[model samples]
Target: MSGQLVRSLLIALATALVAVPLGYFVAPWLGWGVFCLGLGLQLLFHFRNFARLDRWSRHPVVDASLEGEGEWDGVFGRLYRHEKELRQQIAQREQEIAMLIAAGQALTDGVVLLDLEHHILFCNRTAEAQLGLKIEVDRGQSIVNLVRQPEFARYLSDNDFSRPLSLRPERYRERVYAIHVIPYAGSRRLMQIKDVTQEDRLDQTRRDFVANVSHELRTPLTVLAGFLETLQEIELDTEERQRYLQMMSDQAGRMQSIVQDLLTLSSIESAPPPEDEVVDMSRLLDKLRRDAEALSGGRHTVELEIDGKADLLGAEPELVSAFGNLVTNAIRYTPPGGRVRILWNRTPLGAEFAVEDTGPGIDAKHIPRLTERFYRVDRGRSRDSGGTGLGLAIVKHSLGRHQAQLDIRSEVGKGSRFAARFPLHRVIAQG
Candidate 1:
């Protein structure tokens, strides 16, 4: 038995023994009455202790010092210690839950937790943005209803979570997401979402790059191969033979140009940023004018205008190649009587090296992609003009190395202007 119970029994036994003997010594009725009085007093004492216990129970505090008197102290002390341990365990569990939530929120990928019925239980901030969900509002809503994609609905129904689902959400049509569902904690599911728009675009671009390169190189190789077979198999006059040789040479040169341009672009992109080297803007402008005039071959009127005396700070060779491409493009596109003006001017933002041409201008839609490799507004016309289609792309990368930007402003039938604007840090004012 407990110590409190044993003590109470002994106290009761002692009370009965003392009361009965004393009462019997005086009178028999008195002995019985004394026993009854002792019993009643004992009952009253027990009731008073019970009332204190009840009060403690109504507003119990887990404190070691908060206890009862006599035998009840042990009972109150044990209860307080047990409650303290229980509270500590509860706080520990709460802390673990908080840490788990924090870790989920720190992830870049979206995460959603769902019950067996696919009801949304928890979703992190990334999930909220990617899937357009409000945790507070959508907490018990079904995932199928919230996503509302037919394919996604089908994927869930099929229970084939073996492969991740790749889809563009209707709300975010431009972005692509890869979704994976893992069945965990019995029947509940964990949904993970990763944004793969850039990866997808890069993959597509790689495919297009390979296809375009093959197409461009194949045409010239085929022409050269056909003519070589002709020269070997057929007998021809000296004049015809010379003409055929010239055509073969032209094809060879075209292939060489394309290869050279590709190599230049690859080098520019792969190489580290060029060391800061002073470039003479005045001299560069003069060289551009000469190169443009030579490339023009009296076809267009080439003019040079220098309104800025600021020298640029970058690799001169890269600057030459970039600025030269702009001039060459202007001269090649402008008509025989038209004007091609190469201007080096100071703007509010920075120094601008612009090539303004009275050529057939570009459409607005085509201007944005003009700097992409092998991108041409008109493929036939570009090929006829003997362009490798990588000039603007080269210009773009080269300018990027110098902290510059290529700005193309064009309107159909109104001619075009291509400008390379250098940052203020790159411009050195001549004294």
Candidate 2:
């Protein structure tokens, strides 16, 4: 039995023992008075202990150590230990919750928690930045009313979280995000959001590339087919037949050039880094000048200046391709009688190969995307110049293999300058 129960029994027993003997020895009324007195004393002791326990329950900080019997002190000690354990458990849970919130805030993807009524219960920093949500201001507010996206509101109401919803951020037009909702604890929901703008742009670019290639091939193929039909169906004069056949051959050559450039680009993309070798840039530029002159056909002036560094360490063929592309691009773009200058020299950082032209220059806006594959600032003019629109792109990828960078400067009504910069590690200057 508990100490309190044993003490109560002893008090009752002692009271009865003293009261009964006194009742027999003296007057019965006097014995009854003793019994009442003992009973009152025992009841007072029990009430004081119970009142102390009640006060401690109401105000836990208050000391419950009773001044009375040993049993009451034991009761207060057990209660105090139990209360301490409960408080420690509560503190541990609070710490775990704080850690979870910190981790969620650090995530790149946005996270949002909702109540059964679709109210904003909690959200991370990413959600606030991505979705324009304010946690403190939007708390307890219905999510649909705050986000203001019709698609998202419909998604929430539909209760179908099998598929994710794609949305454009309110502040940015080019950016795209994917929002997904999942059912969670007790009718609450979790919304996860991811940024997929780059992926979306890449997919669109891929589609455009396929379409452009098809259109480019289809034009020449259609002309070749028509010429073949003409050659087979009718017998013409010798001179007339020669002219038609020559035109057909020219068309075939254009198609062949496009195919060759595509193949070159594919090779550059798939091949590993080139084996280290010395490149006699002086010799390479000399040959490139001849080729540019032959291509220009005396229509444009071509010049070369290799006064600085001449030799370098790199893959010879890739470097030749990169330099040749820049030279050819200058020749192709310059109008008749325009001047084209090719220069190779050493700078503080490394070596630079530049192609400057006197033809009509490109706009500042178009300069940034000049090296993108199949990108053209003037589609009609590029086609007329017999360009496949892959020259700059080829230069960029080939130079990348050599750890070089291409810088472009252009102003409309003036001319453009294209430069390839080789870092110090790759430049081996020959005296």
The candidate that wins on TM-score is 1
lDDT of 2 at 8: 82
Worst 10 residues of 1 by lDDT: 60-69
Give the C-alpha miss distance for residue 156 in model 1, angstroms: 1.7
Using lDDT, give the best candidate's number: 1
The lDDT values for all models are 0.89, 0.87
All candidates' TM-scores?
A: 0.90, 0.86
Model 2: per-residue Cα lDDT over 156-177, one tens digit each? 8988888899899667767899
What is the Cα-based lDDT of residue 29 in candidate 1? 78
Q: What TM-score does candidate 2 reach?
A: 0.86
- Residue 294, model 2, lDDT: 97
